[model samples]
Target: MTKKVLAAVKTDVETIEIREFDYPTVKPESGILRIEASGVGGSDPELYRKAGHVPVIMGHENVGTIEEVGEVAAKRWGVKSGDRVALHEYLPCWNCEWCMKGDFRLCMEVDFFNVKDRLNTDRFGMSTANKPPHLWGGYAQYMHLPLNTVMHKIPQDMPATHATLAVPFGNGVQWACLDGGAGPGKTVLVWGPGQQGLGCVLAAKAAGSYTVILAGMTRDQSRLDLSLRLGADYAINVETQDLEAEVMRITKGRGVDVVVDTTGDPKGEIVKQSIALAAKGAYLSLNGLEQQVPIGEIKKRYLTVRAPRGRSYAAVELALRYIGSGRYPIDQVCSHTFGLAQVHDAILATAGRGVQGAIHVCVEPWK
Candidate 1:
């Protein structure tokens, strides 16, 4: 095995630098992963642009092969070298109530943003890289997999590039189907045509929703078109058309049964519109950075507002199954690929800046 590992480290806001780290020595309770693909999601841009934690390696959605597994880790994770896996970002304390309940994503110990003192928290991609065994993120050739790391085995037939989608797909299943209650004969309105929004489109459709309407801006024409191809009943250009009027017309004035907003638009215009577009008693699954909501309107509509945090263990398992099923052309969502050297450009593409018509971007360390 190589003694040194290369990684794209986010040294500061809107900045990335290639750095090298000593290969981590696998302890009896830890392992190592040779990263194949690291997905760049919508939040990646925000993380890149915003100034918070510096000197962190920021690739959360990771897929790779197990390179080194300690004796205890091998038995604990039920895997050995050469096993393909998808790594979850959260590293929870197993003793917590949430962790015991299998909702490790909610465990407070892994809440890096809320907790102070970097050593106390350990979230992949978000934690500072200054710590020892600093391979904490996926923008690297190999990542250290501590015993607390949560991972799902990818099907043998699925390629690493496709398996990189498990994060968004898991979120889609969690928000659209599980939380939003989208099912047979239901109507869903997805307020963005980005990767997460498109994933929700597929999740709603797969759950037997009769109508799935995906709304986006003029720049997202290609994404909107792709939504239609991936089982969306309608793709609305919110920039060109009157969103409320079009939605009312499609629902015959009743509004949709569920509304999922993944735009992460700080203006909160879509959140306001979602209130008017939702059917009475409908569920609204919201995933955004910041928003100003009209609480009175939500209360009047009796809407069940749900904030989807992270994917549950079951959701990740289901996502792997969905990815392996040969269902939708999910590979198409991976619109751009970049090497470790082009980490900055890859993030720019994900942020809709450098690359045109880019959707889901992947960073391949070895490339």
Candidate 2:
């Protein structure tokens, strides 16, 4: 085994430096993972541009193989050498009530927003690399998996590239199926054709929604087409067509039963549009962090508004099953791949800046 590991460290706003670190000694309660693929989400650009924690290794969605596992960790995690797995970013204290209830995503210990100290909240890709072990994130050749790290075994037949879809697919299952209440006999409107929005389209279709409509700008023509191929009933180019009118025309003025906005629209324009397009007593699942919503409009419409956080244990399990089923062309969603040295361009690709027609970008640390 190599004595050192290589990683892409974000030293400042919009800056990435490839650095090397000594391989961490394996502890009886911990393990080391050889990263295969690290997914780049829409949020990655913001994390790169915003100066929060300096010199952080930022790649949260990670899939890798177990290179070294301590005896205790092996028994507790039920894994051994050479086993492929998808790692969850959250590192919650197992003793917390949220962890006990299997909602570890809500645990305050790993809640970076609520917690002040960077060391206390150990979120993969967000935590500072200044701490010991030095390889906390997936934009590296290896990642240090602590005792409390959450992971799921990947089926031997599934390719690592396909397994990389777990996180986004899980979010789709969480926001669309679980939070938006998309199912049989329901009409769903997903207000973004990004990777997350496309995931929602798949989840809604799998859940047997009567109609799944995906909305996007003209720049997302390729993504919208892909969404249709994945079972979305309509893909509206909101920039060209009248969004509300087109939606009403499709549903015969009844409006959609569920509206899921993953646009992350800064001005909350899409959110307001989602509220207006929703039917009476409809469910609205939003993933945007900062958005101004009209409370009076929500109350008058009797809408059930839900802000979906990260995926739960059940959601990830379901997403894995869906990915393993060969059901939809989920693998097609991962549109681009970059080597560790191209980490800057990789994040830019996800933001639709550098790469043309890029959707879901993956960073191959070893490449």
Candidate 3:
């Protein structure tokens, strides 16, 4: 009999079922990953609430050890059995224009947003696992690694749970520092105190920004406070206090040098405020999926807007080293961990519906 791997499969709306799958056969240019800590992303709640995506294993922020690696894969990735690694969710076709331009995250072959095909492995966990070799997501005890899978080697000493943060932090470094021009002598503001928002705060401060302000609603005061402790210079309660007044005062009416909104504001209110709060010739990164943004305002303000999706490979490598630096209280950000069977609870905790003060929720597939 063939060995079977256990996985917490997303079977329906707000549902997860324990299912068994045949252990994937590692062919040349392919591998298998024994999941260590699969970080539950902030987006999981929205994904869980949606229907029609059932039968997909839904953890994409994966960190694991190389359980099995084919000869070709081992040579290509420069890794062997037992090597610790973190995976970027994208599995890009190298021949595409996006991949050739180094923005492989936007490759159509793995564009989960637009394309629909289970076999394409478009952004990992978004694919259907009903087909054969169903170990495609990190929620499982073992995940299949195809030829195009982007894997990064993590430090051996880094705790698996902490290593789970590589992707989010990579997003931070990518959007805040690299794209938004956050660094010394710049004042940066990040709206939303969620995992990605806090990552931006850490990135801004680490890059030696003159000031780092985190803005959120009064209900998010706890997370806002936590952001301060994580090195943010200021935490604004937008509901209780005047955001524009505070930002102007903080910047001496010059406005901020950089602004990145991770709030995913559907109303695009933050997008307006971002333009209003940006200094002349500022950089604004709207990570929020808002479509109603005022293009005219951005042009009038002379703001350079960047809409970044995922991290670049360089950012992930830097983020991993930053995570291992023992600088910030990252443990505070990683507040909860659940076993494979507790995936439902884990997603709730990440969504803030289950656990109180939940910052970064993780799933230990083996536990």
Candidate 4:
């Protein structure tokens, strides 16, 4: 049978291509589910622009249904061939020291989307594209997920649509709240009220942060408002207000206890202002992939920086629990959904920058 999928062939280009390829015959090498619906994420923009290299199949976040199972994987996850699940983007090398230590995120040898073929050669496991079509991408009609990378089972009662944000939202939860030590008395300054930043806001609040400040441009008003509703103590428009000064004033000149930047544009003056507004010993967590951080200034300020690689299945599961608990409106975050063919429109909407919450571009592959 032939597999149909879309691929970014060159810098600034996309095309739907078809090829004779094997479908995933095994769902459980470790415990994997055939993807039902894969969601697009911000990291995709870099691939779309070919910022690093050419011919990249650029999607990571996804949710799916189990089509097949390996005996070992089935025993471990307790999932059958028909269960729903979530996929963790980072594929770790199980033989690595980090994997042995249970710190799969730190695995030196990691396989992302396009590079899957280098690790697995089994049928329907992970393959490379020597030509135009790449089945490794989630844009395909069917996705081949290797056992080592899949994580989390979506409960039958939960909506598969909301579960799509499990990865990105988990990122926000892990960085700002869990790793940053957000608690009853700490003040958190979350820069950029986009999906990730808003996730931080929700996580900080869930973790009992005393003060949550969302900093963003005037165009981000929609997200800022949603942040306030989610749990932000204050929303500061950096374009219309002095962000640093406002944060200082909010903290009574003590500065926020922690600063989280998800804007991905660190060299920008606004990010510098966030640095200036942070307490001398404050913690700084960066989630934006596009920004280059100023290490020198961070050193001068004695900032305690914690960089998280990506959300694991465990972290994503935790976020799902928090969402399921009814404390915050996780379901409200997905402001949009679209069919696979509508991906261009979805990207345009997200890139336009007025989304009130997490702007998810959903793909209904079966549709």
Candidate 5:
């Protein structure tokens, strides 16, 4: 029997068509899972807006329960059908040079949400690494996980909806804790107080940063409040207040040791402010390019501007472990929950205002 699923089609400029398609009827592979809740990403805003491209599956962050599994995969991953798991975006070529060094994220044949295959066109742009064609992305009713990729079993006690936030939160931990060297006695500035920005605040605090100064807009008052609750030492309203002055005041003129730019606004003023707030040797980690940087300051200050590479599955797993440990509250990042049908509205909500404290956007898998 053919199952039914939703497909994100570009209907027009700044619009998406959520039409249903026949789902994959193939059986599950050994040790693999059929995911449930897949998380949406901030990077996908352009895709939704049809700015660059239009009409793709349009989901990356996700978690789900194992619906069925092949015998071999079940034994190998210690995951059986019905086991809850969070999906990693990358499906690495395990034997590749990078994967050999345990850098799976750098694999040349990596598939981000199984969108494309770098090797053969024989599959009609579908990835045939280790899973069947039916299992591809989580935007639909089913997604496939190759045996070699990093798919961890989340704690049974944690809801998959909450677990869906892991990818974004893991991004926070990876960018702030592991990449930016955020930890004890260090100060970090988190620019853009959206879900990802607030996540940076929480991750830096959890990583033991001396202080986390948040620079956001006056409209982000709710996010600022949430940041304070999540452990921000200071939250600066960049809209009304002077950003440079606030950063200087918070750091006592020395500037923060690190700055995390989760907002991809290239021309957005917050990015420039973030650059100015970085100390000479400070690590400025831009998760993605939102806006262009001023070359003058970059040349003069000797700033180490870098973009975050793929996260350590192990590091992300550790972040998930931290979430399970009850020490740092992961649920604090989620702001709301909605069924799969409400996806368009969810996207609109994210575009409207900041999902302060990580709004839990839930997608109930078809039972």
Candidate 6:
């Protein structure tokens, strides 16, 4: 009997349904992966709540072993059967200028959000299971790996949960250091103490920023404390104390040299606050959606404003190496894990609506 694959499909607003699909054929220049762990990303909560989209398998941060790979595909990826690897979501057309420059983030082929009929796209995690070869997401027993899929080799003995964190760390390094210009002698301020914000803390510190301050609400004291343990120099409660006053005090009234907000709020309050706390030549990178902030303040302050998302190839490599080096107690960050059957609970916890204090959550398929 042909085997069937199991996946947790996001069927509606804040809903998940376990479904089955036929195992896909392994054509030349393609492969199949036996997924071990899939980290629930910061974006997962928002995506889970979004409506009017096709039922796509929804976990994007995937780490698995190569169950099978076509001859050409194995050769091209320098990976063989049974090898552990981390799968990147990008399916870039290699011939494009962006791909040639190794900036797959800018490749138009994988820009699912802007493209028309985006629900019918091929980008992993967002692809609909409406068609054949439906194993496009990581919340499944197996996944289909196309030829253009970007992958990184993971060491044999690394824990699947720990290895799965490379994606968020990649985003951290990209947003904090590469784009936000955090480096030696700079005082950096990050808004939020969640996994992504803590990631920015580690990245900023690793980049040699002189000071790293993490801000969260009064209710996030636990997470704020975790940020300090994870390498943040200071943790401030924006709700209990004045955010701008506390930031200025921490920076000795010089304002922050680099600022990053991971809260993903649609309102402009955080963005405006970031502007108010920036140094004369500071850099600001916010993950929030479009907000009406005063552009004049940015111009007056000579602050460089950037909105960064996704990870770079180099950043991914650096993050994996960092995780493997055993430099930080990364296991503490993997605060929650659930079996495939409990994907809904995991999402709820990560969304902060169910379980209290879920730092980083993962779905272990065989758990």
Candidate 3 all-Cα RMSD: 1.5
- Candidate 3 minimal-lDDT segment of 10 residues: 112-121
Candidates 3 and 4: which is better by lDDT? 3
Q: For residues 81-123, what per-residue lDDT tens digits would candidate 3 score against the true structure?
A: 9999999988888898999999898888877666654435577
lDDT for 118 (candidate 3): 42
A best-first ranking of the candidates according to their lDDT comes to 2, 1, 3, 6, 5, 4
C-alpha RMSD (angstroms) for model 5: 4.3
* Tens-digit lDDT track of model 2 for 1-367: 7598999999988999999999999999999999999999767898899866678899989999999999999999999999999988999898989999989999998887798776447789888898889899999999999999999999877877677778888888999998778999999999888887888898899999999999998999999999998879999998899989999999999899998888776666878888889999999986577786789999999999888688887888888888788877766777788999999999998898978999889999988
Poorest lDDT segment (10 consecutive residues) of candidate 6: 286-295
Query: How accurate locally, in lDDT, is each candidate?
Result: 0.87, 0.88, 0.87, 0.66, 0.66, 0.87
Q: Which run of 10 residues does model 1 get worst, by summed lDDT?
A: 112-121
Deviation of model 4 at 67, angstroms: 1.4
TM-score of decoy 2: 0.96
Q: What is the TM-score of each candidate against the true structure?
A: 0.96, 0.96, 0.96, 0.84, 0.83, 0.97
- Tens-place lDDT digits, model 4, residues 1-367: 5533443222334332233344444533543345556666766554444433433333466777877778877776677888887777666668878788876766655534234443242212123344322445554455655556557877877766677778778988878876788779999998887777887888888888899999888778877887887899899887798877787788899888887877776565545666788787788876444555588888888888765566555667778887667666665677777665555454455666433344555554555
- Which window of 10 residues has the lowest lDDT sum in candidate 5? 121-130
Off by over 4 Å in 4: 1-21, 27-32, 51-57, 111-134, 287-301, 353-358
Best-fitting candidate, measured by lDDT? Answer: 2
Q: Over the full model, what C-alpha lDDT does candidate 2 score relative to the true structure? A: 0.88
Compared with the true structure, what per-residue lDDT tens digits does model 6 show for residues 1-367?
Answer: 8889899998998888999899989988899999999999888887788886658898888999999999999999999999999978888888889889989888888876668876666578887878668888889999999999999999999989988888888888888988888889999999888887888899899889999999998778888988887779999897788888888888889999998888876566888788889999999887665686677887899988888768898888888887788888788889899988899898889888789888889998878
Which residue segments of model 1 deviate by more than 4 Å? Answer: 117-120, 287-290
